[model samples]
Target: MSKTILITGASRGFGKLWADAFLQRGDKVIATARNLKDLQDLSDKYGQALLPLQLDVNDRAAVFAAVQKAQQHTGRIDVLINNAGYGLFGAVEETTEQEARAQMETNFFGLLWASQAVLPIMRAQGGGHIIQVSSILGLVTLPVLGLYNASKFAVEGLSETLATEVKQFGIHVTMIEPNGFTTDWAGASAASTTPMEEYAGLRKAFSDSATPDSFGNPAATTPAILKLVDSAQPPLRLLLGKVALPFAKSVYEARLAEWDQWQEVAHAAHG
Candidate 1:
């Protein structure tokens, strides 16, 4: 059976890739982008299967309005993919107030607004799925991506809480924690703070660690997404690329070891 899927940031990257995939498989996709023009090709190809709308996810009111319009179009949305965030690259101290706030606004608050907007509709329908496009940085840290890491970490916390809260309503929440993919995420879509001389070595080390295999092909993720949305039991979190799992495992193992080493000190604080 075909489902009605609403996706944000449908102009390009994973948003566009998944939208095209869903439409190809006969699902009704309500695609939202900041510039509606970016979706014209999809609209031309898919006809009624694609409903393109202009949206800036940072605008809370507009997000709610867009959700309402999408619900009216399909009567009930079976799934929502919140993929409307960008990367903010910088060292923690180098980040400006405006940049940090903007990162949270779109990446955290934007997802919050969209989640809130769809709740009433999904509740009325008795079920739905919400997929948040988080990153591997959400689980672990990387140098020179402090703001982006913080934003994704916020997404993880919010979405985890949301999953527990909405389980009773039969609304499933999943965070897609993708590692570096061959998308424009690190390219034109990324915003960077002015480089500080102190962080140059750190940046160089980070850049030097990259191998061609570190990034996955975005197109290859289609099947995983399709299966996730169609599943009777979807995971609370899904890692997209090959690198994510190993990276997460290493990070978490180290975290556990450190926590255990500090357990006595941590426990003493409670007294």
Candidate 2:
């Protein structure tokens, strides 16, 4: 069945690639971005199969309006892809209150508002899928990326809760945990704090670990993403990229080891 997939931040990066892939598969896409002009080319290529709308996920009101418009245009929203987010790089102490709040506003609250906007409609339609673009950072911490990590972690929690809450309504929520991807997400979309001498070593280490082209091509995950959307028994969490799976395993292993080491202390809390 051809689905009507509404994608935020559809102007570029993984979101843009998803839009193209969905269109290729003959699915309807309601592509959205802050600047509608960025989506004009997609509109031309896919014709009516693609609907471009202006949406700033940060604006709660705008999110509702965009969802309404999408439902109106397509008559159904089969999938709602919340992909409008950015990385804010900096150590915990290096970030300012305003910067941290802004990061949360877009990466966490923005996704929350969009999810809220779509739920009622999905209930009315009888079923839908909510795909959230999270990160491996959501499961494991990284130096110089505390703010971004916090945002993704919040997304992971919300998406998990949403899955359980909406399962009865036939709505599915999937959190996509992609490691470094060759997308503008690491380029133009990312914002870095003013470098401080205290965090210089951490910053240098981060850069050294991430070599040029170290990230996997975003398009390589397109097929997997589509399969996830099309699956009736979709997983609550889907990790993309070669490193994402192994890295997540390591994180869980380390976490379990800590639990085992402090099992007595953990039980004491409940006692």
Candidate 3:
């Protein structure tokens, strides 16, 4: 059976790769990018299997309208992939108010609107999958990229809550927590704050931590994602890169240890 999958940010990166894969496999794909021109190649290649829409995820009304149009086109949307987000690279102090709000508007609220828009359609259909493209940074912290981390963390929280709330409606939500990948996330798609001289050392350390091996190939993630979406019972959260699990484990362990060390205070606070 061919599924209807709607993906945001389909112009490039994982969204484009996944959209092509689905279309190749005979699924109906409604791909959205900020510019329809960017999706011209896919539209040309896939023909009717591809529905490319120009969308700025930051536009709330447009998101709802787009999703409604997609539902009308396919009759039903089997899956919705929220991949329209970018990274804001900077230390927290260096980030401006406008930059912070812009990050939340697109990365957080954009996703929220898309999810909200699809819920009614999926509910009427009795079942559907919603995949949120989050980051490992959502679960852990890193130097610089503070606003980006905050946005993803918000994504994680919202998706987790949504998963539990919608399970009864036969709606499944999965958060794809990927580590660094060979996407333009840190390049073309990224916004950066002005560099501060005081945090120069911290910035250098952050740069040094990212070796060539730290990033995964975007194309290589196809198999895992396919398996996930095809499963009878998919996980609420899926890590997309080799390093994501181990890094998350280490981070969680440290968090647990710190909590345990302050166990007395934690218990006392409840009093």
Best by lDDT: 1
TM per candidate comes to: 0.99, 0.97, 0.98
**What tens digits encode model 2's per-residue C-alpha lDDT throughout 63-95?**
999899899988999999999999998888889
lDDT of 3 by residue, 1-271 (tens): 8899999999999999999999898999999999899999998898998999999999999999999999999899999999999998889999999999999999999999999999999999999999999999999989898999999999999999999999999999999999999988899999999998999999999998889999999999999988888877999999888999999999999999999999999999998
Q: Which stretches of candidate 1 lie over 4 Å from their true place?
A: none
Measured by TM-score, how close is model 1 to the native structure?
0.99
lDDT digits (tens) for residues 60-83 of candidate 1? 999999999999988999999999
- Shift in Å, residue 247, candidate 2: 1.0
Name the weakest run of 10 consecutive residues (lDDT summed) in model 1. 87-96
Which residue ranges in model 2 land beyond 4 Å of their true spot?
A: 212-214
Q: Name the lDDT value of residue 176 in candidate 1.
A: 98
Residue pairs of candidate 3 with colliding backbone atoms: none
Total clashing pairs for each candidate: 0, 0, 0
C-alpha RMSD (angstroms) for model 1: 0.7
Model 3: residues with Cα > 4 Å off, grouped in runs? none
Q: Name the lDDT of candidate 1.
A: 0.95
